[model samples]
Target: MGKIRIGVIGCGSIAKHRHLPEYAANNEVEIVALCDKVEERAAELAKEYGARSYKDYEELLKSDDIDAVSVCTPNYLHAPISIAALAAGKHVLCEKPMAISEEEAQQMITAAENNNRKLMIAHNQRFVPSHVRAREIIESGEAGKIYSFRTSFGHGGPEGWSADGKDSWFFKKEQAFIGAMGDLGVHKTDLLRYLLGEEFTEVAALVETSAKKGSTVDDSAVCVLKTESGIIGTLAASWSYVAKEDNSTIIYGEKAILRLEEDPAYSLIVQYQTGETVKYELGGIQTNESGGQSNSLVVDHFIDSIRQDTEPAISGAEGLKSLRVVLAALKSNETKKFAEI
Candidate 1:
């Protein structure tokens, strides 16, 4: 209603680097509570935001002062925390890779539906300026008859991005579930669905712990996905990009190939088969490797959805569908065959 009362459920790196700061800056939101298993982390962010700190998330959810919460907790806790918050009558903005399984994800969606509260997944890549523009071009038939694509997202590792650094739970299999596939691959999964406007029907994957020593979960994965439209693409996610990060996508169409975030100078470029190329200087992507500016476009959109009393752009059902694609990839890795999504 009046300046949405916001509570942050995790005080780790995402909360530090993105959620907390972004929420604090939003005029439509007021940071009312902060929570983390680490008391000091919660207290530190609470002190700065003029909010209460809680070691227990249930306490934060119990407070009527909060109208909504951003669930930035680890992968294992996403569904539980978001469902709890929703059941407590709080709108939820959950971090990506919605949950460990499609069933868990569905439960989270059901919770939101039962509570009549808004639920938005923080798939921030869709908010990137160049990506938004690329969607426009593709939809306009400029990138005609898109038949193939290759998209990748990679960086040093979660240790460099998480607030807990190398000691972060991100590497732990039990806590983080699927590693790079969960952390980075899902973003591309959702992004491709957004760009190609199709759902992945089947996938074949090689999930491996090719890099990183501490974690038992996979550190890298290469998946071949065939969308409902019969469009095929390679989706690669890795935590071993020691040289640099590559958050680029090439959408191949009959007329031209649209390259996104491949070059730093220009965020998007279209190379036509007619021996012509067009480059646009849209802003770059914000990744641990790239080191760029990123706004809380996802957060802002969530708030807008709340105020307007409408469904979020990235609703629970939408998130569930994307997560299913990821689960299918994991299954493919195990089965050594194409897995149906």
Candidate 2:
């Protein structure tokens, strides 16, 4: 009903860059609390936003002023904190790679159901202009039946982007669960599912930690995904791309081929089998470098869902489906064989 009182649970780079700013931008949101284990970080943001600061998320969840929370914590905390927030009768907007396992993700969904609170995942790629247009083209049958695809999201590393810099929890297996796959890979998997409108049935992967010295988690990974309709594709995520960020996807269809975020001038391109090409000047996808501060639309969407009493576009169940793909990829990597989802 009134402005949605928001509580941000992490003051990391993700919160600084995406969640906090985006939530502030939404007129329907009033950020009432900021929390982080690092008290100074939370206090600094609290000062700027005029919100209360807490080092413990449980305390923030107890506040009657907050109606919702953004779970911007690390991979491991995403589950427990989200479950707790939902149980506290607060809506939750969790960061991607929802949980370390399917069981935990399912628990989150169940928590939301039991509490009658919304549970949304911050899968921002679904909001990108190019991706929205790509989904439109494919679903319109203008691209015909999808045959294959290859999508990738990569940047130098999280060191420059994470709040803790080189010592960020992103490099710790206990904290992050998985590295590049969790950070970047899951974004592509979610995007692929959004574009294809199908669930991945099988996966084969080669996940490694070849780069980023002393890191205990993977820095590079390549996974082959097959959809329920038998369409196949490759998904690549990496922290080893030292040059520039690459957030591009190419889809092959019976009548046309679509390219997304492949060119600096145009974000979406379609080439018809009839010797004609079309290019769209949709806005650019946000990257890790400069000009990456664009709105992700996740925070606003979460608030909108809560306000409208509707299920989020990226609901907990939708997030769980995408998480299953990443988990299957990890299983495939370990077994050295195809893993069924």
Listed per model in order, the count of residue pairs whose N, CA or C atoms clash below 3 Å is 0, 0
The C-alpha lDDT values of all candidates are 0.91, 0.94
Top-lDDT structure, candidate number = 2
lDDT of 2 by residue, 98-175 (tens): 999999999999999999999999999999999999999999999999999999989999998999999999999999
Full-model lDDT, candidate 2: 0.94
Residue 210 lDDT, candidate 2, scale 0-100: 94
Model 2 spans > 4 angstroms off = none
lDDT tens digits by residue: candidate 1, 1-341: 58999999999888888887778778988898999999999998899889999999999899988999999999999999999999999999999889999889999999999999999999999899889999999999987899999999998898888887888888998999989999999999999999998888999999999788868999899999998889998999999988889899999999999999999899999999899999999877887743444774888899999999999989999999889988999999999999998
In model 1, the runs with Cα more than 4 Å from the true position are 290-292
Model 1 residue 283 lDDT score: 76
For each candidate in turn, give its C-alpha RMSD to the true structure in angstroms.
Answer: 1.0, 0.8
Lowest lDDT sum, 10 consecutive residues, model 2, at 283-292
Q: How many pairs of residues in model 2 come into backbone collision?
A: 0
